[model samples]
Target: MNPLNPLTPQDAPTPAPGVYVPGYARAKLGMIAAGLLLMGLGFSQFAEPLRLLLFGERARAEAVRVVKTKEGLPDQVLESDRQVTAALEPRDRSYTFWNEFRFADGQGSSFEVRAPVGSQLKPLYPLIDEEGLPTTDLVVYDRAHPERSAFPMIVSTWFAPGMLFVIGTLCAFIGSFLFYWAKKPIELPRLPPTAPATSTEKD
Candidate 1:
């Protein structure tokens, strides 16, 4: 038996002399494009306009009136009255809550504000006293325009952008791997047949 020849075919086919174009090239390009897109999306999160577009007025509003008192402590609180319409049935009736607060310009006024039911970072609803009074301060933009207001939610502020950035980074990483994989060449499975050996020694 020939030592050079194996029981199974060991030779692999040779490809054209130039650098090989991987079969997955298109897929790699797609991945690269997707990665770039995700990177762009991540960058957009830091932009003010995108933040405003995604988070709305809350992104630019100034927060105020945070309650600092601990449990069972005496604290001064603002009044937030529930305004409900009796025209409809109990379940069907609509209610509007309002809180009275003084503007920074030394003008005392009342703006509609509501406490959040639950939140991750900060409470959406204001801390209230025993008499349904607001215990916490709220965010405000223009004191003159109370209608443009909202309860603070950290998800829109910190969580959303952070999560988006993380996801985008992961996507970019995966995309880079795919791009590298696609750029790598695959060798052909076929190899050229070997020629008969000739003796180099003199006869």
Candidate 2:
């Protein structure tokens, strides 16, 4: 006899078979990891810019001025190696170029430094350009180390890392929600047809 409802011929409710969604589970896990990595990388990228912003005055104090030797412009300007289809693609490009910053150490040893192609740094002293000769002084680190070299920060640097951070965060949130909230598809059991009824009479 049916315990819940005796009037109707109904099967007892049972749990449906479990679904093995391997891909879904894997994706969810991947998202979590990707999110963490992206966030970490994004924060790491900001380290130098933030530091410079906070203590630029102190860093400037420690920097030493070095002279630029070349006249007119530095000879590093060359045709864009990047091949574009259009001939009139505004080919003129100016890159920040400078001579190596050399300074004397406390022990009378001299050290030289050349800032990279697109650094936005100026010397502590005024640039000296006279007669047809162009010369500029640059302020750079008094000392050099493996991790600490002066490089200018640009807008593009923040774009990719910031995007990764945002995208990763979104992916992680979506993955976590799916992991906790998504319901599996269930397969219900089929019910058998009832047999035909027959009547009997007694005389």
Candidate 3:
């Protein structure tokens, strides 16, 4: 090698043994905690769906009325034209729309319940009829608690739980990977052997 050239692999100093990074333990614990928290939340969100699936009674619910409310505002009724217009336009503020459904329980008790989930853009469930009246929608309510009901076969019913589960699973995988990485010993690349110097003989 030329004397003026930069140091090559053979000339470079040996790397130190890998050690735990500062705050790595704390980071690992934090990731694990966050993952578990999210997982718990995801599981909690699934409770209603699971309860409905196992011990729920299906019924045809009539929409009593559609209520719209902005975040942090009182609920109010919106005209169908206004609702459609609001849905069509870009959202400038957060709004929630839900339908109040009236249905009878197995014991012939009347109960009015709100939709399980609200829509940000438009009212959920019970499509409007030609006469501008609410249509009938299927509702699944817990057998023991008739008031606790949800609209089955809708995306909103499962969206929260599904998203939470996915995010929690990803976080858990990342946390596990970090834990394994933290405990495992690190290895450095081995240096290649240098060629022996050649001697020029007198010709």
Q: Write the per-residue lDDT of candidate 3 for residues 109-165, one digit (tens) a residue.
A: 999988877777666654566687767778888888888887876677787887887
Report the number of backbone clashes for model 1: 11
Candidate 3, residue 83: Cα displacement in angstroms equals 8.7
Predicted candidate 1 versus true structure: per-residue lDDT over 112-180, tens digit per residue: 433322232222344355666544443433344544444344345445655667776777777677666
- How close is every model to the real structure, measured as TM-score? 0.39, 0.39, 0.70
**Candidates ranked by lDDT, best first?**
3, 2, 1
> Higher-lDDT candidate among 1 and 3?
3
Best by the lDDT measure: 3
Listed per candidate, the RMSD to the true structure in angstroms reads 13.5, 13.7, 7.4
Candidate 3: where is the Cα deviation over 4 Å?
1-23, 71-74, 78-94, 126-134, 196-203
Clashing residue pairs for model 2: 123-139
The whole-model lDDT of each prediction reads: 0.43, 0.43, 0.70
Quote the lDDT for 34 in model 2. 83
